[model samples]
Target: MVAEVFPLADIGLPLGARVPDFTLPDARGRLVRLAERLRTGPVVLIFCRSEGCSCCAVRLRAYLRALPELAEFGAALITISPRPPVPTLSTEDEHRRSLDVLGDVEQRVFADFGLRRELSGEPVPATFVLDRQGVVRARHVGVDHGTTMEPADALAAVEAITLG
Candidate 1:
């Protein structure tokens, strides 16, 4: 008998589930609340390992490149990591400046989202498309080091929420 393997995305916070509201500090030290942002429009919420992770950096840049389209759809992009934000190289700094990188220093928000890795307790990279009502419209939890939802898919998800 063969046991079917399910993707990690399927395990936590099933589809249509209303995400819990929480507050975390952004790069500039401003507290950002989930409910508050929801009042404006849908959000592309990303969970990443840490500010220093190379894979997470790549994922961040991908989303950064998609910012204009996301703005067109009236969806905000926010990234939360287990560690605090740090200064980066000049080239990367410019791109990073455009993103609202929140620090989940205590990993409380990660825990609330059920996004921690089983062995290391580090955050597993994930992307969640949330509607204005704070319900999760789409979610993609990465299976390993460099896996994550593509910007195109996330944009599509946001487009659905905006159009529907």
Candidate 2:
């Protein structure tokens, strides 16, 4: 049997594909379902390695800073990590409350989303903009370990989806 090869660009979920529904627990242990969030408006899904990773922390913080702008577009940010959620200090409570930090300890959601790195088996730092209908409008999957999608680009994707 011949092996079927997929192009490098097809490594992760393609644009226009409908994302599978998933339910993951947030930092506060509250269950957040993807389908439920879609009911409100567009959703920005971010997949990161771990909270301890400096790169991941930077990506998360950037998104946190863009939360207000994202809210203006009626888009919600949801971050998924392979490890269990660890509560942060009280100082970040307000920022943390704006987005949902989900824990996918089993990595099931990462696999389902096709964001797993082939070699490390870790979730690739990815940003997906899903419209209210659950269809992927834009996606950026990191090819390098420390690389992640920029907050402005993600917001632009959401803006386009919201506007168009």
Candidate 3:
């Protein structure tokens, strides 16, 4: 007998490319469209599994720690996952905890971004920094415990974009 594994999609968006539009409801069930969200400022899109994933948690902690500073750089952080809402915990709660972990329970955004993969029965991990115009400026995929995006790095990217 042979075992079969699902193929993984290339995680990160290519540099200097525009992010495709996607609309998913936040935990509050309000529609959040990427194009609409970016009208204010740049956006950091964090893609992960559930809140229980260790690496996910670590990455979010980094984002949480740097939220205030990242805001100074003029970026709106948001996250997505495929996990549906639960009884005790809601997607809104996830967003509140991290200010970036929006719920993508429908998997629409995952499919649109080519990040839909089953890496251990969980969604593939990825991140993207999109400018206000929705072009992906930087991207990282498949995180390790210590591997995550830094606010300083994002600030640098924003400076480069705005200056150029």
User: Which candidate number would show the highest TM-score if scored against the true structure?
Assistant: 2
- Determine which window of 10 residues in candidate 2 has minimal summed lDDT: 89-98
Model 3 / residue 48 / CA error / Å = 1.1
Task: Residues 33-148, candidate 3: write the lDDT tens digits.
Answer: 78776886788888877767777777766776666665665667777777743333344534543244457777777767766654443466777888889998887765342466
Q: What's the alpha carbon RMSD for model 1?
A: 4.0
Per-residue CA lDDT of model 2 for 28-118, tens digit only, reads 7889899987888899998888889898888888888898899888788888889988766233534534478889999988888887766
lDDT of each: 0.80, 0.82, 0.67
**What order do you get sorting by lDDT, best first?**
2, 1, 3
lDDT of 1 at 144: 77
Collision pairs in model 1 = none
Local error of candidate 1 at 85, Å?
1.9
In terms of lDDT, the poorest run of 10 residues in model 1 is 89-98
Best by lDDT: 2
The clash count for each model shown is: 0, 0, 1
Residues 1-164, model 1: lDDT tens digits: 65444468554576899999999886667787888878878899998887878998999888888987887877788888888865352335335333467889898888788786555666667889999999999988875758888999999999999999
